[model samples]
Target: MRRSSVATSFLLVSALGLTACSGGGSDGDDGARKAAEGLATALAAAAAPADGASTPSDPLAAVTWTGTDPATVAKEYAAVIDGMDGIAPSVEVAEVDGEADKPTATLTWTWPVVAGGDPWTYDTTVALADGDGWAVAWAPSIVEPSLADGETLDATTLLAERGEITGAGGEKLVTERPVVRIGIDRTKVTAAAAPASARALAELVDIEGAPFVKAVKAAGDKAFVEAITYRANDVPAAVRTGIDGIAGARQVTGEQALAPTRDFAAPILGRVGPVTAEMVEKDPDAYRPGDVAGVSGLQARYDEQLRGTTGRSVHAVPADGGEERELFLAEPAAGKPLALTLDRRLQTLAERVLGGVTPASALVAIRPSDGSILAAANGSGTGGQNYATFGQFAPGSTFKSVTSLALLRAGLTPQTQVQCTPTVTVNGKRFKNYSDYPSSAIGTIPLEEAIAQSCNTALIGARAKVKDGDLADAAASLGLGIDHDLGFPAYFGEVPPPASETEGAADLIGQGKVLASPMAMATVIASVQAGTTVVPHLVDGVDVSVPSEAEPLSAAEARQLKAMLRRVVTNGSGRGLADLPGGPVIAKTGTAEYADGGTIRTHAWMIAAQGDLAVAVFVQTGESGSRTAGPLLEEFLRAAR
Candidate 1:
């Protein structure tokens, strides 16, 4: 019967009698069908839009009136609905029986018990005859999954513990550590002063004040406005003292699994916090409101493995002081540990060394034997840029190592005679060596001597020796300009085909269309020392495959290139590193030029190898590779020993 027909039948039935009766009447079948149809309509209305709107404000409003004592049922239904977090309820009417005026309606309730569908359905009958026309006889028992008499709907959440992140030696990289949460305690200060207080805190903490001010101004009058979270040891002693002196500012201390030092490999470790609304919408099955999970870095990349599966249980509580029945039980599992390939000592040291650089700078170290990343450090002056593995900058003269491979592939040896000049022009672009180019190495010299002295004009003078794609091929062979999946954000060097001879000349000195991360340059130096490809890796067992068609460098050719780089430290531009206390060393220097807001600046770069260790250092806006980057490399090598 139509919904209107059900209304008509209900009016006729109520006029006769809607209360429970002793026997069936002549129109019992029609009344039963109409009552069942009415039940279906009421339940379906709960899920339908209202008055041309997309969604109804109160989804269960229609069903509330269909039960006995509408006032009491409405409150109870709202309570149950409010408690359900990830439930989508649906209902259907199946059959009915008894007198036409006091018919019993059979109903089936279906809803997903778990996310992504593990539907649980139950069938029950409701008496539709009371004082009103076809009034519904409702109770908690007729709800989805058949709630027990006098029992209320509820939920119990079992949270899985967050995981830990470890380093190469299986030492703790991130673990439960003390932290400080700085915020404004509303009870101690008026909301009107929130903006001023935020500015004060910003000045004291060295963070942006505008966003904090806005957040504070928008918070409730009695809300505690949290500003930022920092590892306990990270908050400078002076800053913490200043905070303690503030009238309304306070610190909330807690412990969480995090890096021992807040800035130690921060870009790689990431963080965990309360789940965002946008994240929940994207993965509804994996999250809920108020849940916390990894948001970025390795924490987010391995969140699933780190945050183990959650266990759940359902209990049927009794109204009378009796025992509760266990309806469902699933034990929880703790999270697992994420292992990395970092060297804790080395990473810590690298951070300290770069901490003072005035311009953006980075240091990357790797062990070529197994392609493991030991350290990736970004200086405080970098403004939080992850240049160690992600920043793309011209590599400068350091790229000559790759060019040497190209030269080697073209039949030139270290002793081959090549002209080293003051300047040369290619494709209408004039190229010159550094202004202080040593006169002794500027004339006709051995090919190795040209590389050692880092002569731009000399390398540019030999551009005819390299064809289109040959430099790119040679770079790939040394693991410089290649394709890779390191399982993290990284920029392997890129060597696009030079569009002109000038571009080729630029390419010869690590300029033009070339770009590389500190990590990429480290791999180049490491691969040269190892005589093959060196693909950098961070996470253990997470194979970082580099897809390259370029042939690997031969042991013989690698030794030849190695010998040339050695000469750099012993007799040329890199001579400053000759007296390093560490074991014998091989090094190359580079200076890359780029335009910064209409002003010209150069990036200083150096790549070196000593024993099993290989390192790359970069300083954006530096004078020269040897002068700017040499000391940093020396410091690292000395400390590593």
Candidate 2:
């Protein structure tokens, strides 16, 4: 029962005098307060372990009971809260009251249900009599005011609704969707037939049979061991029929957080499932067995904000078949929605453009105006890798754009003439153009024409025009090497300063050691189109600061770069995208060579900017950027139009 502070104080003063007279101690007020405090300390010690120990101390050893056995009362008290997930209460002496022979101490019991939550608190009084010293008067009311002799407490968790993941314009991306949980219900079949049923169900669901059989054998007699979960409509008719015929197979329908399609932005959006053992071990307060949580991607990164707070309640159930009464309750709070800058329609279109690609590939698109990432799609050939924003590969001739910027900053203009030779050599290493380089375009030509034809020799020949770190500085202005928090997992391309002249020459054509993801290449074109440095972002409302060390891109440089790129689409390798549906497309195509397994392989790359959208397409194995990645870019531009 709750009493006002004034009344509690008055009761304590009256009880202190009574306790002094009843031989609590000879020192009157001080002695009585000390004795009462000692009793409170014992109650606290018995409530829980000291310093996070697993086992709680015995209450019988801490208290002396009168007219009742201490062991029996302690056992009864332990059983009252057996179902509370090992939660312990904080018991402290609130006040002392009553007469000379029967002084009472009110102990406040507060139970911790969840981390950082308001505790469940209530007051219960214990009688104290001087049998030898002060002995606790044993009764059911000492544990709780309303706790009867035969009632026990039970705790139940109330799960909160998971929040939705929204795209640009607040359209729901990951939300509640119907699903079928396929499993083996062991109770429906005899133990002898369970293994055969599990194997049959596994084969019908396309899972391995041996593992399913082992799992079925290990599960409890009444346990339901799940094999897999699929979208409700995705389960095949034949598989459903096979499950129904199996001895113990069952299907349960439910809703879970899911995207529009299984693969729609999967690597970025992630998925939710039962918490793993590692997750529970890492933060036992936040997760428990059978708890569903985000396991990967944005879902895992923002799990605390998206998973919401789980509510808990303790009910007092009567052993004599009476109605249960609530002792504590904490209402669950729904999770907050996470917003992203992705354009669902554009993202879906980009994925479709690469649907037929058989090599590891990626397509990334961005809005240069605001630096918002519109789409990041990976082809099936990527084998579940997030190559769109994290793949690090040689950018090939597309890096000519960064080299051009370095040369432009060093006083070389588009009109300046340079030789586009068939081959160039540095440090005894001969470098030649791709096999399909045009014979007519190979000769002394303007720098702009050299870029339009993607002349590797022309750029390498101009390596002396800029010193070391010049290429990296230029790449940084185009958002290649510099890292940003971005509020998500992303890999910025790397462009370290060359260690030697030969390496320097190779760096100019984006070869030696330069590496970039599709997102970084997309940002390069986006910067040129925006006329300023662009930092690509996926999650909404995250502050991505530009590095102070990076030289800011100027309008004049972007304007000249944009013109050279436009000429490529109109007259050079990117001519395939010249008739794209969108407005005039400024583009660059690249083919980089790398030795794989003692054989030569090439990475195809193409970057383009059309109207407000900038796009990059990359194929891990291809003939050439113009032939491989350019067509995908053109298809996406047309569809996105």
Candidate 3:
């Protein structure tokens, strides 16, 4: 039986004086054995820490140990509790060998030299003698075999340096940035003044006032109630001086381990925040309550890779006072960088193009050759949402490129004569072209001219030449709606089959159930520009490699579409790009209409190709696709070149 049972039985025998319970021996020895066994069990539990807390497993708490020194035992127990807060040890005591008056037994225990490492086991002896009843003889040596005069347990942490997040060209996008936590030092200010100080800081920093006041007021005296964290370079000198004038207001600067720009590719790169209780509970081995880790985005997606192993060390110090001796330990390792495909220059350019636009816009650029994403930028209007790669919006006329592919598959060449009507009704649903539809090219125009003009009714009229699945399949052929791992979250645009003729007509024009992200549409333009469906990627050095299901556009289809798109830039609505310094720019312009709050709003979209880059840019509400988004597109391509 386990030693604890023997000690437990000892308590019962001594308490009941069960002389008749034993066959040949007196219950005295049995009681002594049980006491020793119980002591060993309790010691083991106390030594092995669980989730950062100490628990005593010895069965000796119930019975009073008669000969035990209460004060000595209490101090000794307290020392053991403090020392064993973070270790796992096993202890076992053999049955008593001495007589009842001065019973003694051998005890053995094994302690791990380091958590999850080799162990150190040793044997010692303890005594159980008569008192008010049988009880343990407590001593420091009972706790550990190496115990001498006086020693206590001690621990110290060894932190490992975190890794860096690198961008394309291997520049550090996120490194060890200097930061400051500004808040009220409650102790320096009166309770009545804390609220005013907190409110002043909140307004200066533009954070909510009530929460700041509540947090400051609730904090104990001498507590530093942090209101906000900011990078040292970004905080204004004027604001710092203003806070200095307020008593108890202060800024504590330190090295914050995270990215530099708060909004720079946040949705893709991710953010770092305080380690939550859930994080500590879920990963006790990796995270602690006060640690900072990736809370969301790519940081959260690849947290472990970025947060390397941690090291620890435990020591034995003299309880009376002396230098600590190393007992157990491990070394921490620094994390490695996560390579990316984003070009810092192009990403900065994309952001600059959408800088002043207030209506949730995005600009995405991808390489046609390998589908490597060059830039994914979201405007301030998005309020931190990753609209570049996940925003679901109709491509408007931008999707006509997909419809064009479907048409070309049906033996309809760019020169195939198709009517560019003012309005075309399908199954009682009416679709109209833009109000400025050129009159001379209205009736019986070649498909090439129709596409160049972004003639909605032209494509709606030609919708009869294809089935609903053709539009979806064509989009899929260009990498839309196809599922593959990118090691992060994304929506590759969805072009589901139309349920009715009205839906089909709308689908033909890149509207009516046709949903896509800016990144998604960029891929569509890229496929045509590159001749094969392009799979966009972000994380470099990841296993996102997948086989392509899309066949490159046939030579005839490629030749014809290229000519048609080029005409759109030269002779059609996209004539805005005629002066682009990048010279020959091929493109398509789209103005998709949607109902918001019962009012019609249009998304001006422009997808284009200049040399090796395929780009997609959008504006939530605009006058026209070419006129509204065209200037931005031209600026980007010219600057890119």
Candidate 4:
């Protein structure tokens, strides 16, 4: 019984295992058949047209469409297949209703034409596909290829905040714009007989008769042109009537007009002109025609700061046969005003002081503490001729100050004994003093007395004791033989360093080869008065500033120099200045002989401090310093104070 039971259990287990395996196989077959049927149905549906039509009117009825050229589409498809190397599944076209006329029937996409924050409208044409979406048809226009690299369109007019040019006490010296100008449009008087038009324009505008007729004829060729000349200060009341008389004439404000001052400081202030081609070629971005620029003095120096940046705009115009449009526009820029360090009172004083003297005389005054050029006035020569900085003459006895300083630095004192002989011989040359007086009458004199007396012999005798290089170095330290770098052109006054020992001896007496400008001589006296070496400045503080590192002289030396200079006014050559009412004056005088062998014609000079101001005057082809230049300095000093 146990064996029979074991046999039945084994048969039952085998039967159950076989039955389970067969059932598993049948379920796998069913699932495979269902999946195959679903795929076949999808393929058939994709290939067939809508509504069960046998064939469609369009060749691309069963496939999604895009606007791209057929060649590009083919290339993209080939590229995708090559990229995948046949490992990816193949793509099939899908069909939809009205696919023939619709390029992207099943696809939808959002295309952005104009970029963000753009105010103008843009035209964008996009292509669509079945499921891939859309792309831009063309790229943004790169229209500036013909222009030079980095070049762009810029506005012609510029607007800027002007600075004020004021006097020393902060009073306004330069005024701002206060009026507007109205111009007539001369081009539109197109009547067959324009006599009435011209007469009407003359009535309304400032121009008249022949000029008005000429302007109208010239402007007729231009579309919109301004009259050659317009009314300044105010618009004429008749302009409205004149414009009404003409068919299409108009009255408007012109962009260019005169500033209100009417050339108050004309030559000094300079004028503006159109930019030239040479300037543009040198710097492509620097300037354009019809732009105003500084032509002289302070104007030229501070042009960059005075002139400012320009602005821009747009005016739209309709494009031909299209929805797109064109734009045309511009914005103007204004200029900045300049503030000067000039004292108007002092300038007027200088002009008056220079008037009585011949046109050859020149004068310059400056403040010592800061090297601020207070006044500069020049007598006439020619156009743009300013002798104050440009004239070169023998400095004469004024150079004695430099010679004395050299002697002092070389261990000589005011009491140093120096014989004042009529003539002294050095290196085979005989150099005579200014006068032919005997040495007995002017024996050994004190250095201070020699300077006060304007004794040429004493100065040359004293200079003999010092080396040539020392005198040159001393004179240079006092601002000789070097350009002061003032805004305008200045001659450094030729004091060629002595080439030989013989030339050196001649230089000592203010003879042979010593030259200086009136401006430079004034600077020397100012240095002595201020007790420090200073460069004379012009154009206010724009050209130069006081050197932060300059060291001043000792108080004792300053006091001694001041005392010696004072004696020159009270008891010596400059006694003409002694009678002035205000206060004590200190001065020096010079009468330099010309190289042309005439009588002492050009008087070179120095007028030291009178109260707070110092003045130096030079008169070419004039009398002695005392007679010719001293009186002018005295007159100026009294007026200046």
Better of 1 and 4 by lDDT: 1
| Backbone clashes, each candidate | 0, 0, 7, 13
> TM-score of every model?
0.80, 0.85, 0.81, 0.60
Tell me the tens digit of each residue's lDDT in model 1 across 1-641: 00122333343233222233322254465655555555554443442224353433443333323535545665565444433343445556667774545567777765444443344456877766633333456666656445665665544456667778899789999877888888877667777776788889878887788977877786655456777778887777877789876657888897667887769898778887666668887886777654568888888888888877655555665657378666655555778998888999999988888878899899999998878899999988777768899989999999999999899888899998888988897867888888788898878999999999998887778888888888989888878777666778888979998787778789889999999999999999998888888889888777666565768778889899889999999998888889888677899999999999999989999999988899999999899999999899888988988
lDDT of each: 0.76, 0.83, 0.75, 0.53
Residue ranges of candidate 4 with Cα displaced over 4 Å: 1-164, 176-269, 311-337, 425-430, 433-441, 481-494, 537-552, 595-600
RMSD of each: 6.9, 6.0, 6.0, 22.3
Q: Per-residue alpha-carbon lDDT of model 4 for 151-236, expressed as tens digits?
A: 22211233333344565666566544443333335345453535456555555565566655554554433233333234344454
Q: Tell me which residue pairs clash in candidate 2.
A: none
Over the stretch 525-621, how does candidate 2's per-residue lDDT look in tens digits? 9988888888998887788667776798887898899999999989899999877874788999999999999999999999999999999999999
Better model by lDDT: candidate 2 vs candidate 4? 2
Off by over 4 Å in 2: 1-75, 97-103, 127-141, 180-229, 235-253, 320-322
Worst 10 residues of 2 by lDDT: 1-10
Candidate 3 lDDT trough over 10 residues, lowest sum: 16-25
| Alpha-carbon runs more than 4 Å astray in model 1 | 1-72, 90-133, 140-157, 178-255, 310-332, 545-548
lDDT of 1: 0.76
lDDT (0-100) at residue 113 of candidate 4? Answer: 11
- lDDT: worst 10-residue window of model 1: 1-10
